[model samples]
Target chain A: MIEVHEIVKKYGENNIVLNIEQLYIPKGQCFGLVGNNGAGKTTLFSLLLDLIQPTTGRIVSNNIQVNLSEEWKPFTSAYIDESFLIGYLTPEEYFYFIGELRGWKQNEVDEFIGGFQDFFNGEILGRKKYIRDLSKGNAKKTGIIAALIGNPQIIILDEPFANLDPTTQFRLKFILRKLLENKETTVLISSHDLQHIVEVSERIVVLDRGCIVKDIQKSEETMQELESFFKDKISLT
Target chain B: MIRLLQFEWKAFLRSASYNTHLFIKIILALAALYLVILFFSLGFGLYFILEEQGMKPFDVVNRVLIYYICIDLVIRYFLQKMPVMNIRPFMIVNLKKNTVINFAITKTLFSFFNLVHIFFLIPFSIVLINKGFNLSGVFSWCICILVLIYINNYLNLLANNQDVFLYGLISVVCIGGLSEYFGLLDISRYTSPIFYNMYTGKGSLIVLFLIIVGLHYVVFRFYKKNFFLDGGLSIRTRSVHAGDYSWLNRFGTTGIFLKNDIKLLSRNKRSRSTLLISVLFTLYGLLFFSDGLEVYENPTLHIFAGIFVSGGFLFTFGQFVPSWDSAYYPLLMSQNIQYRDYLNSKWWLIVIATGISTVISSFYIFFGWDAYVAVLTGAIYNIGINAHLVLMGGAFIKTPIDLSKNKNIFGDKQAFNIKTLLLSLPKLVLPIVLFAIGQNIFNSTTGYLMVAGTGILGFTLKQRVFKQIEKIYQKEKYKTLKAYKAQNNF
Candidate 1:
């Protein structure tokens, strides 16, 4: 479970990028955060990862206060940006490094990531090339696979499908669906792709400017309703 | 063509203009060069007026050619080699490579140092000719000097293309060895006949010109063929193991910091090079002080100088602590790390480094027990003093350094800021003052023992000094960040 209570973040005087009040993500649910560019999605993710400090209020994850502590960090995995991937290391090396950080043995890491090998079509694991050399889709795959390697209780992904091809995006959706069926892992993904969000996420939150303007659950409404709602909100603005 | 030149000039000036620091640097460079030229020109003018009574016509003509050749070579080498400009970006445009190369080569001709060569050489040559030396003799010497200058420049370019320091050492050794061999064997006497005609004024001027031109062509051809965007050293890509040093688990934060320091030093080329050079320089004292104190009758002065030289490693390595982390400082600050732990890591790193240097210097200590004791005292004093000084200086100093950019050992850009210099003053003065006061108070052995004892005391009190510095760092954290960004013009 993740709770963001009245978080406020500012760059300088009067330049508040995020102003939000009370957002609770229940355990074992897929939450899709949708926003246009510069709608504070990345800022919120950064705060969640403890990459930056919030100006006010607090974030609590799994009963532990969200801080830059090893305990809180181990249970959470996030791919906020490309820089999260250490560009110098190969996919296999990065996976092992992340595993070691989470105190997982080599066999454990191999076993965990080995499951995603079929999905990657034999392109990712054990490739001796650096992440910088990998194509955009393959790099995203590498990041996603590593994040999922530790089997963290909570996972956050920012624009996971941004640079991926259609085929890879479809494969990723399939993987997420499988993850959702487990009912133990909580996933928060922020993306602009409404179609994919509608398909994978159980709960959808639409953010405009720096505020969450709409929240809809899949069980609460049909897919067409949410689509129409998003269209109407965008046109009204 | 003129428009292209204007565009290039605009770009260079604009880049320079962005940073007030770089603009100051350019002005300082120009001023320094101007002063050097003025001094040399004054000396030459005095020599001509008083000794030679002005230059002869032939000497003037010969000197002009020599001057041009030397100036051209130096300018060409600098223009082609300095990676600062990175003219590779121009290659992707509609501009031809030849045109760009031509522009670059032409820019070399405008150097003030090159102009200085012309001023001094031309006047000196004229005076020599006026003093009744034969035209051929004057011309031969001038042409030889010209060729020598080109040879020097080309050699430097070749060395710059390779590792600068490694090739510089090789070149110095080669020149020293060759000079010694020639002096001993009189090999020049045997080869004199080959150049006898040229020296005697019978050889053609066209031949000399052709030779110089051919050398220039060769340099250009070599550079043109091999000089791609990434032609020099192959970039090494290493697999970084996260949490690789589990041994640090014992010391907790200190251990983690030490491990990170080790990883950083190993991964970054500048830090690694600085560490390597520190070791090398510490050992260099051995070569100088090998003979023992009796070699210099006054053991006190010799020991003092030895002590100063022995402390070289710490001073050089400690000076750049803050600059090393400039690039990743934001990430470092954002992490929930204690200020004391960060400073302690640096302190420990210096201790480890100084310890290694002290052990190496122990070899020289074997020559005499007194020398051993003196060096040990100096090393210990430096370690204690520098640990405090570096931490304090790091807190106050706000210079941000990009370790990725290749900098010279004595580059002005990397040299003393007010904070560093001010911090260094006490380190310098304290050692000398301590040594002096000790020498006045007691016998040499007793004084040496006291110095050594005080150094030990300092080492014990280092943690307190470190804590004080850490408090200062915490207090001025934001200011330091601002300073760092300001210094680098980030």
Candidate 2:
């Protein structure tokens, strides 16, 4: 679970990027955040990870104030961007590195990656290619897989579907569904793909210019409603 | 052409680190002035020194010219950055390829290497003229040397990849030295005549002029053929090597960190150069010890050489602590790792590097036990004190290094910053001062023992030092992350 209290991230005077008064991501929830360009989704995620300090407030991950203590790091994992992957490391090396940090043996790390053979599509492992040399899609897959190494209580992924191919995107959805079966793991995924998000997340939150506009549970009409909301924004502008 | 020049001017001026660039340029100007004065003095005294030794000054200059040329090339290879233009922008714009190429070539002529030779050449030529040599012949000889310097400028284009040129130069020197030793060939006998001819007639000047022009054509054609981005300008990617360093896992998390550092140094171009330079530093004692065995009598210079011999890695690669991970710093910061562990791992890394360096420096034993002990004491001092200081200094360094960029000794902006310059003072000065205090009060053996004792004290209290360093790192974490993010724009 994660809590955001009066989180306001400002670049300079008069530019308030993220100003969320309160946000509570409950345990075992499949949370999906959707936003347009410059919607401050990444900024909010960065604040939660404590990569950047909030101008006015703080973020608490699993009851630990992320800014005050490093305790939350053991239970939380994130794959925000290519920055998550070491450029010089092979995918297996990267996985083993993350695993070692989370107290997993090399063979145990091997077993965890083995489960994602279908997800990796044989392009990542045994290729002997550094993450830098991989195509964007493959690199994204590597980061995402590495995040799942130690089975952290909470996993945060930003724009996980952007660079992925359609097939891999579908596989990622399946992977999310499988992750949610545990009923204890909280997966936070942000995406531009409304359909993929709608199919995967039990609850979806629409972010518009740093404000949470809609928070709805998945239903038969959810996809149509979300699509029409985005459609109206294009016409309103 | 004017527009292209304007673009370059604006790009240089508008860079994020323009102030850093300006400061470095001022420093470089001062250094150039110092070098000019130094070379002038050397030139003024060259004739007198040679006369004191009862040798012909002109013959000596001609004979040693080949060595000077080789040394110049080696220096230029490390220091000169190949003139670059963002040709990709011009490729789609309304610009001719020839014009762009010509601009790039012309820019090379303005390099400091081309101008630096004039400082020594002009003063030495004046000395030659004062010695009652023919004016026209001296003029022709100076012109020939200038032409050869230009030829070297163009010849350097083919030697752009540093490793190839460095290895080639070393081998050439070794082979030449061996042949000369065995009396198979006298390179000076052959090379001396070439420069002597320049002083005797104008024909060699014309010949040297033709050679420079030919070199220019070759370089121009080479650049022309590989002008496209995919052909020449594309980033060179080496074959991926995934070496298993799990053997290092015995030390636990520290081992993992060290393995990653190893991979980083071996795989990345910039870091690889740092590693190479560190390995070479172990032999730094050669500069002093090669002069004479009497160097052992001077504890001050011996201590200085010893510090460099083992502390090369600590000074060179150790200063850039978290910046080496600047590319993925956020990931490390957010990972399930303690700040103490991270700093401890870096300390261990420095210790291991110093240990390896000390072992390599054992070859100094052939010089004497005193030289070996001096190096050993320096290594202990580095591992104990300098390692902590360098890491602590690294906490304040927020600049990000582009690890993929090929190393240019003088081209890197981060290589010479005010913070690093200030930090280097204590790292280099403290040990010598400590040893000097003991030497003045007691004797040479007492100096070594006292310095070694101080290092042991620091080493024993390293845990306390790490606590303070970790606090600094924690305080500066967000600022460092912000700086890296701003520069990388990701």
Candidate 3:
């Protein structure tokens, strides 16, 4: 579980990017975040990961202040972009490196990656290619899978499905569903795909500009409501 | 064609880093101006020096031309980036592919490597004419030299990434130098006549001209065949066998970091070049020791050489510490590792490399006990004090390095900026100045002890230094992450 209190991220004077007064992500929840371009989705994720300092406020991950102490790092993991992947390392090397950092033995790491054979599509491993040489979708798959290593309690992914193929997207959704089956794992995923967001997450939060506009428990008509809300915003412009 | 050039000009002027690029360019131009002045003086004075030796000045110059071309090729290989055409944007427009390729090839003719010739050749030709050589002969020879220089320029572009061309030329040069040294074969006897024939108004001028034209067409055709967006613009990827450094995992987190650092050095082009430069630096003491043991007694220059001899890796790789991982820094920060452990691993890596360098530099002991001691103490100083200074310097660095870019000496502009220049004062100068203070008050033995003492103190206080550096790193964490995210597209 994570608690964000009075988090305000500003670029300069008169430009507030993210200004969330209070946001809580409960344990074992499949939390989905939706936002348009420049809606501060990535900024919010960066603040939670402590990649950037909040102009005013703090983020607490599992009761540990992320900025003040590093105790939160062991239990939390995130893959926000290509910057998460080391370019020179092969996908296998990157996975093993991260696994080693999280205290997984080499054989254990190998056995863990073996479960993702279908997700890898046979193109990621045994290809003698570095992660940098892999295609964008494949690279994204590598980052997402690497973050799943070591069984972290909190996993964050930004735009996880953007560059993925349809098959891998479905596989990732299945993976998330299986992860949420446990009562302690909290998975936070941000996406632009509304349909996938509705199916994969039980709780969907919509952000417009810097404010959370809608926090709805998924229901039979949740998709229709989200579609109509975005349509009205477009027409108003 | 003119519009294509205009597009290139606009892109350059509108770029976000234009001011920084312009500043670096100005500095490079000033440094170049100094080199040109030195070359001009050498060329102008060459005829007089040869005359005093009772040798024919023109003949000697002709013989040396082959050596010049060989050296020029090596320098060009390192300094010249592949000429960028930005052809991707223009590919969709209404234009002939030939026109674009032709424009790219023609643009390469104005490269600094080609134009820098005028600085040396023009002065040499002026001296020949003043010395009363045949005017027409001098004219033909100068034109031939210029043509050969262009020939080298095109040959370099054709062989830019070919290891065969680079290594073959190096071996050939080494063999030729050795042969000349041992009196096996005199290359000048063969070269002097071939070039001297041009000065005798022979028809070799036509041959040289044809060779240059042939090379130009070959380069043009090569670029044409590989003009696709992904083919010519991207760094070529070769499948490399994964190396196993799992033996290092026994040391725990620092070992894991060291393993990753080794992969980084071996796999990236830019980082691999630093390894090559460090290997070269191990022999740097040769410059001081070659003058013999008596001249090597100058303690100041000995310390300078000793620093280079022992701290080769510290100076080249240490300066780029966290920037080496700038691409994946956020991943590092978000991971479960401690900051002190990260810095400790880097410190260990440097200490291990300096240990190797110091062992190799024990060859300097052949000079004298004093010479090796100077190197030994310098290594201690590097391990104890300068390692921390270098990491502290890295704490202030916010630039992200493109690890794959191998050409263009100024491509890694972070290597030459004002911050590094200011940091080098403490990293390089302070040790010698500290030793001088001790030596002036007592003996050279006291100075050496003083330098080693400071290193020992720093060695013992590693945790305290890391605590302070960790604070600085924590403060700059977000700012550095922002910079890397902004500039690092690779």
Candidate 4:
């Protein structure tokens, strides 16, 4: 579980990236955050991850203040961008490295990755090239897979479906859904694709500029309503 | 902690020599090890060498302990890198900031630069022990010196954190100057006797140890609060074009390329810091030309210092050539720009830099016009000959330098090595050898003419050299791009 309390991030005199008064992402929920370009989605994620200190408030992950202590690091996994990937290693080397960090055995990691071969599509592991040399999709897959290692209690993926092929995207959804079904893992994913977000996320939050405009539980009409909301924004633009 | 370091060690090794042929790494490692051992041996044999040179080893070293420690601190401050273990993955983990930072600090304590001073002290102490000096006191002195060195390491981190360490550096220089002046004047001979008494005094190391612990505490507090991966990675300001390089617009394709090159150097912290450091190094000529004018009697030393002073900007910037743009190299490669034009743009930047340095160093005319001509010849040769050699050397370098990391002067282990420094050695040394032979054997004018003639001939053959290096670049293009794409170095 993650709590953002009175979080306000400012860049100078007036520019505020996020001003969420309070947010609690419950355990076992596949929470999808949807937003436009300047919707402060990444900013909120940054605050939650404790990459940057919140200007006005605090974030508590799993009952520990994110800034006050690093106790939450053990249960959480996040991959926001390319910086998360160590580009020099072979994909296999990278996987083994993550395994070493989280105290997973080499064989366990191999077995786990072996299960994702279809998702990898024969393009990631066992490849001769370094992860940096992988195609953008493959690189994203490598990062995503690395984050999932250790069977972390909380998983956070930012723009995970972006830079992925359509097939890998579907496979990733399947993987995410399985995680959701576990009912013990807290999954947080942010994406621009409403349909994909709807397909995987049990609870969805919509953000505009730094405020949460909507927070709705999934229903049959949720996808149609989310689509029309964006379509209306487009017409207004 | 060991597990964390183990990962770092693996990254260090696996990341190195990815683009280089295996045989070269072996040879280069052997060569660097050989040189390190050779320096250690020189340290071991310092007493003998000083005796041969008619200097009293104990008298000199004892008297100049302050000078040695002070100068070493300044030099270490400039060149020594802060040991950084990228702690990003550990941040959200159960790992404590204390554990991570202490590992980084401890690792730095064992850095080659820190340990090098011991190489000298150990030998000197052995000589003192052999000479029947108080062994425990000598041992304590050595421990204190080593502690002081570690303190310097922590102090360097603190100073580097503050941006400019000029105050510390200036105070060191002023103290040394006053000490030397008074030490010579016999106006209450101060620093030498104080240091000598401190070293010979009993249990001085306990105090030294206390100072080190206090420093460690300060350094701990500093890194604990400020250590963040985002600070290391994030672009603090958007000034990709903060400076006006628009004057380069007139020079056609190469000019356009040069403008971008200028922007890259001005924008990126790593490259910009190196450029600023190189400019600071222009002051190095003062070290050679100011003192014993007798020092420049050795033509090899004189010309080597001269070239380094006048054309070092080219050397530093050119040696990394294409690697500087490795981050955006793929985009550059995919552009409609011609490879020759891009190469020429780099060449132009080096030439223009060399010219500015040569003119600045022309002030050496006060020392001797021959020295001035030598600086000019060095600049010309760097422009005409070593420029292409550097480009040729760049073509073979596969380690992509992180342009953005303000981490340190040398971004990563692979980005710079003794072998890369030696890449243009023959070109550099050939002029030195020719100038030496011509000056000492023939005449001073022949020395200047010999260097100048070589520059002229090389400038004439510039087209041939460019053609050769271009072929080399073509062969290396694909592999270079592959290596550049990887964040192999953390």
Candidate 5:
């Protein structure tokens, strides 16, 4: 479970990137965060990850204060972008590295990665080039796969579908669905693609301009509501 | 062409760390020019110095000519980058590949390095002319030397671009140096006559000319093949090997960081070059050990020698510290790794590196048993005291290194803080002073024991020192991460 209490993230003077009063997501919940650019989705994740200190209040992940203790790090895995990747390493090397960090045996890592053959589509596995040399989409796959390595209880992915091909995107949905089958698992995903988020998440939260604009449970007409809300708001801006 | 050159000049000057401080860049440029002038004067006086040192007048210039060329080739091999045609935009446009290739080769032709030989050969030739040598023989020899300089330039490019040529260059240089050192063949004496023959032998001058032309043709062809397709679109042969440093696992969390740091140092170009420079430094004996035994008698000299001898590579490499990982520092900071384990892994890595370097440098014992003792004590203090001092100093560093680049290695822009300079200073000076006082008060054995004793004290205090370093690192973590992310000029 993760909780944000009266959290305020500031950038210099008069610039508040995030100002969330209270947020709580219990374990096994697939929490979807939808936002446009500069919607403070990343800022909130960064705060929860303890990458930046909050201007006010605190974030507690699994009842452990994020800033004060590192208990959340063992269970949390995030791949926000290429910065998460050691670009000099090959995808396979990077995967094994991640597995090693999480204390998985090499054999177990190889077997787990083998399961993604269909997902990989032969573009990423056993590739000769380093992650830096790979195409953007392939590089994204590398990072995403690295994040999913080991038995991380909480998964955080930012813009997962951005650089993925249509097939991979379709495959990623099934992956998320399978991951969510474990009731004790917590997944926090942020995306501009409301459709995929709506399909995968049990609850969806919309963020706009450092404020949570909408928090609604996913239902039959969730996609339609999200569309109308974004259309009306984004057009006005 | 002028416009293109102007645009390139602007791009080069504007984008480079030239923007950091104009005063710094100006000082750097002057320093570079000063080095060239100093080396040129050395070349200019080399023959006379050899004569003074009691070599025959004629054989003096001839003996050193080959060594000078070899040193020049070696320096250029490590330093010069191939002039790449920035042709990505032009590739999709109405440009011929040959035009771009020709422009690139021409750009290389005009580099300061191409004219550096003038600094060496021209002055020597002027002196030869002034020393009542025959004009035609002197002219013919000058022509031969100038032709070889051109050959060195073109062949240097050949070595740069082709893997076979590059490896061949490295092997030739390494094997040649080793062979000369072991007295397998006197390379200087064997090659000396070739230049000496150029004075009277029209045959030798003709041969040198042919070789220069042949090398130019070969180098041109190699460049053509590389830039031939799509105007050098960078179609490189990529290969990846799986590295398993899993044996490093028993240390728990520290093992994980050690594995990553090893991969980081081995896999990346910048880091690999750092390792190579460190390895090359194992030859510090050839420089320092060349001194007389009298220098070894000074207790302080032993400490200085130990600093360089034992920790030659690590001392230089460790100062950069966590900044070398500035590329993925945020990822590291986000991971489950403790600051203690992170710094410890770096410490152990430097210790291991210093151990290996010390072993290789153990050959210094050939100088004397005293040299050997100094090296051992130095290694102890270096690994124990110096490593911690550097780690503690590194805690204050916020200048993130661009590990993704091998663009400008010699720009040597280390942000050495007062804390770093002051702390690491005692690693060298303190050992010397301690050894001196101990020797004066008691005897030489006590002094050696005191140096080792100081190292033991530092080693025992490591945990306490590490705690303070950990606090500093955590306190400055955000500022360090911010600085790292700001290095975006890939």
Candidate 6:
């Protein structure tokens, strides 16, 4: 479980992004964080990962405070941006390096990464091509697969489907479902594609500017209501 | 065409504001140039004083002008940038080929070193004409200086454009060997009448000027034809995982950092070239060391000689360590790692580099085993003193350096503040002062032993000093970062 209490982030003198009160994310649930551009989705993600310090807040996970525990780091995996991908190494080498960092044996790393051979359509593994040379969609696929390598309890993906092709997008959705079913991995995904977010996520949270505007769970009539609500809100803007 | 020149000038000046240090350096360069002119005038005044005592002024002035022209040729060759700057932009433009070529040739005139022809040669020409030398003589020498400058500029551009360094080693060997062989045969003198006549005073200045002009035209024509061709900037695509190093696992983070550091250093042309040049200079000193009375008379000069010989490793190795990670420093900082480990890794790298250099330099110790031992002693002192100094300097002196740009070894833009100078002064002056003190305190053998003992102690204690410095680095990280960013515009 992840808990954020009174998180506030400021750039210079202005509090451009903020989190009021408290929020909790239970284990084994898919949470879709939907926000428009400049809506603090990335900043919030950065804060959770401890990449940047929050102006004022307490973040806790699994009875351990966020900044004080190595447990939080080991169980959490994030791909914030393309910069997260080390460009100098081939996909295979990069995967192996990340696996080693997680203390995985060579045989284990190779075996696990080898499972993605078919997923990549035989384009990535053992190709001896740097990540910088890979196309945007392929690079994203590489990042996602690497994050899943150690089977972390929580995976945070930012804009995972933005640059992917339609076929790849469908495949990724299926892969996420399978991972959820098997490992009960709690996934937090941020996206602007409302239709896809609603389809994949069990709980949807709407963020406008920096504050959480609405939180809803998917139900029998919730999808229809969400579609109408989203349309009204966008039209009002 | 004039508008294009104006645009180029505006763009250049606008880019200068990108870094405050770079803007200050440009101003400093202008002041330095003015000082050089003032020094030259003072030397001319001294010559006038000497010439009044029955020595011929024309001969002295002529020799001075010739020497200046030679130095100008070398300086122009190294500093000229017109060929690359002009040709690159013209490659994709709709401008006519001849027009582009004409611009490139004319741009050579804008180089500051070309002004030497006007300053030195023209003034000397007036003196020669007043002294009743033939007008042809004055004109010939002036034209010769101009032709020499152009020849040097064009040759340097051609060589650099063609990736000449790839073939440079072989070319040097071949030329050296051929010159020696021809000198032995005694028939080499007949092969080129120009060289023979130049030595014998039969060479006309017109013939020399015409030959250089023809060579310039040929080179210009070649560049004009291939200016837009993609031969020069071809990116080498390679298989990324060509070699896998399983050994990296054994050493952990240090191994990873070292491997990555080496890769970054090797991939960057500027950094790698600087390292190579430092090694080459070490070898030059080793090859040139001589035991002479003139050099050893002053204890200060002796210690200075020792420091200069071993100082290259410290000066270049630690100078750009932080800047090498400028692009990805934020990422590195975010990782759960200690600042001490980062500094320790840098210290070890300097030790390794300095060790290799000292081994190479030991071969040229001319004063027998004593000189070799002194060099070894000095090398240890340099490692301890200079390495600590660099870390201490890094803690306080915050100057952001762009790793991508090539910086001269003694460039004015490098952080040469009072703080850095004070930090460096102890490294340079203390060893000499110690050696002098040791010499007075004991017999020659015991004095040498004292100096060597102190060096060993310093080397051994370097780690302890580095740890203290690293603590300071951690505490002052934000201040250092702020100062670093403040020095740069972006």
Which candidate has the top score in DockQ? 3
Docking class of 5: medium
Local error of candidate 2 at residue B454 (angstroms): 0.7
Docking level for model 4: incorrect
List clashing residue pairs in candidate 5. none
TM-score against native, each model: 0.70, 0.92, 0.95, 0.60, 0.88, 0.74
Order the candidates by TM-score, highest first. Answer: 3, 2, 5, 6, 1, 4
- DockQ values for all predictions? 0.17, 0.76, 0.88, 0.02, 0.57, 0.24
**Cα lDDT of model 2 by residue, A8-119, tens digit:** 8888898988889888999999999998989989988888888999999888888899999999999999999877889999888899889999999989999889999998
Q: What lDDT score is found at residue B91 in candidate 2?
A: 73
Q: Which prediction has the highest TM-score against the true structure?
A: 3
Better model by DockQ: candidate 1 vs candidate 3: 3
Candidate 6 lDDT at B293 equals 42
Docking quality category of candidate 6 according to DockQ thresholds: acceptable
Ranking by lDDT: 3, 2, 5, 4, 1, 6
Relative to the real complex, the DockQ score for model 2 comes to: 0.76
Interface RMSD of each: 5.7, 0.9, 0.7, 18.2, 1.8, 4.1
After superposition on all C-alphas, the RMSD of every candidate to the true structure, in Å, is: 7.1, 2.9, 2.4, 19.5, 3.6, 6.2
- Candidates sorted on DockQ, descending: 3, 2, 5, 6, 1, 4
lDDT of 4 by residue, A1-237 (tens): 888889998989799988898799889999999999999998887666655567899988889997666567667778777766654446776676566546676699999999998999988876566665677889999989888988888888999999998999999999999877869999999999998999999899999889998889999999988888888898998
Docking quality (DockQ) of candidate 5: 0.57
**Residue range with the least summed lDDT across 10 consecutive positions in model 2 chain B:** B406-415
List the candidate 6 regions with Cα displacement exceeding 4 Å. Answer: A1-5, A15-37, A45-78, A81-97, A105-107, A118-210, A213-237, B1-27, B30-138, B151-250, B284-288, B291-297, B301-308, B335-340, B392-422, B443-490
Global lDDT of model 3: 0.86
Scanning candidate 6 chain B in windows of ten residues, the lowest lDDT window is B186-195
Query: What's the true lDDT of residue B124 in model 3?
Result: 84
Report clash pairs, candidate 3. Answer: none
Better of 2 and 4 by TM-score: 2
Clashing pairs in 4: A73-B92, A73-B93
